[model samples]
Target: MKTPVVALLTDFGTRDWYVGSIRGVILVRCPRAQLLDITHEVPPQDVVAGAFTLAGAAPWFPRGTVFVAVVDPGVGSDRSLLAARADGRYFVGPDNGLLALALANAKRYAAVRLTNRR
Candidate 1:
């Protein structure tokens, strides 16, 4: 079995515990999963920057990489979260254009609103 690569991109600066806590949770669930930080300096809540950065970095990663982007300004609102597959990579993030650029040029892509909290 191959270890899964989970790439994280967020505006959560390293000065806080947010990034570390996210890593901890991922590690706890998938002990062998490899975590890579695409970036954590996305100019807080700037979804456009996040989208651009993610799209730029995404193509360089190997296929099967899963990206988690967290640059949503509408965090606690009724905004929907999305789980998307573009080309062969996966993306999970708020449906606020953060994942749009990355998925735009994909030859094959699909997305679903993540409504089930379980």
Candidate 2:
């Protein structure tokens, strides 16, 4: 059984509590989750950069790894959250095409636009 990894890619730099706060929440929920930082230095509000960063690195992780990506400008907007499974890995992020390239390259893919938020 492969280890469960949670890879994070965000535009939020390490100047504030954003990245650390998120990591705390994830650890609370998934204590055993291996956290990997794809990059927290993505250009601010650059979804294309996030997309490229994630797509480029995702294939290197073991299957079943979960990717949690948050790019800028649409963090708390009404934009739908996405849960995507591609090439045996899972991705959770905004629906701003950050997962586009990876999903396109996947032999098996499925994506859901989250509608229910409570």
Candidate 3:
């Protein structure tokens, strides 16, 4: 009976309203979702920074955690979204090669590029 935690990583700055809006979107979708800000100051479009932040914190979190990363410079573009599974966790983000080296082991699970969520 534990609450699920959603670790969010993005390039949106704290000064802007993007981060807040994303949180709000999550809240509206799932009020019980525990939103954890991994980091908003991810070097402003720095994909590596975002991947590192997510890959670092993902392991320490409990099972069933969802890592939502949005360091995408290709947002709303044709870069295709991804939902990767690794080490008892789920990762949701774009397929921008940034995540190529995120995971520690990098060879544990299958990585899939999801165009649309079901």
Candidate 4:
């Protein structure tokens, strides 16, 4: 397969290193992975805004883009991480009801909860 390109969408701004940290992790995991940031100011804790931003920008990326949506309020908690492969793209984030509404437009290929991973 070709090198994967990951698009990052987060509420964390550029002033901080949170976004950088995520990028670093991806770099280490997939040395050839390409990283792209959709936006950092996602109206903090606003799932609706993040959903809107994701929907609008996602269609523009090339097929197989790994989209990381992180407008997570309950991240790393009871909230389950979700990976949705739609049309030819992959999405990772919390299953906090933000995607179900917007995913109506894309073709859902697969969906699984992170909790199921052992």
| Whole-model Cα lDDT of every candidate shown, in order | 0.94, 0.91, 0.79, 0.84
- Provide backbone clash counts, one per model: 0, 0, 0, 0
Estimate TM-scores for all models: 0.96, 0.94, 0.87, 0.91
Query: Which candidate order results from sorting by TM-score in descending order?
Result: 1, 2, 4, 3
Which regions of candidate 1 deviate over 4 angstroms?
A: none
Local accuracy of candidate 4 as per-residue lDDT tens digits, 12-101: 889988999999989998999989999999988899899888988888999989998888788667777888888787788888866654
> Which sequence of candidate numbers ranks them by lDDT, best first?
1, 2, 4, 3
Task: Point to the candidate with the largest TM-score.
Answer: 1
**Model number with the top lDDT:** 1
> How many pairs of residues collide in model 1?
0
Residue 101 CA displacement from its true place in model 4, Å: 3.9
Candidate 2 accuracy as TM-score:
0.94
Q: Between candidates 1 and 4, which one is better according to TM-score?
A: 1
Evaluate model 1: give its TM-score.
Answer: 0.96
TM-score of the candidate numbered 3? 0.87
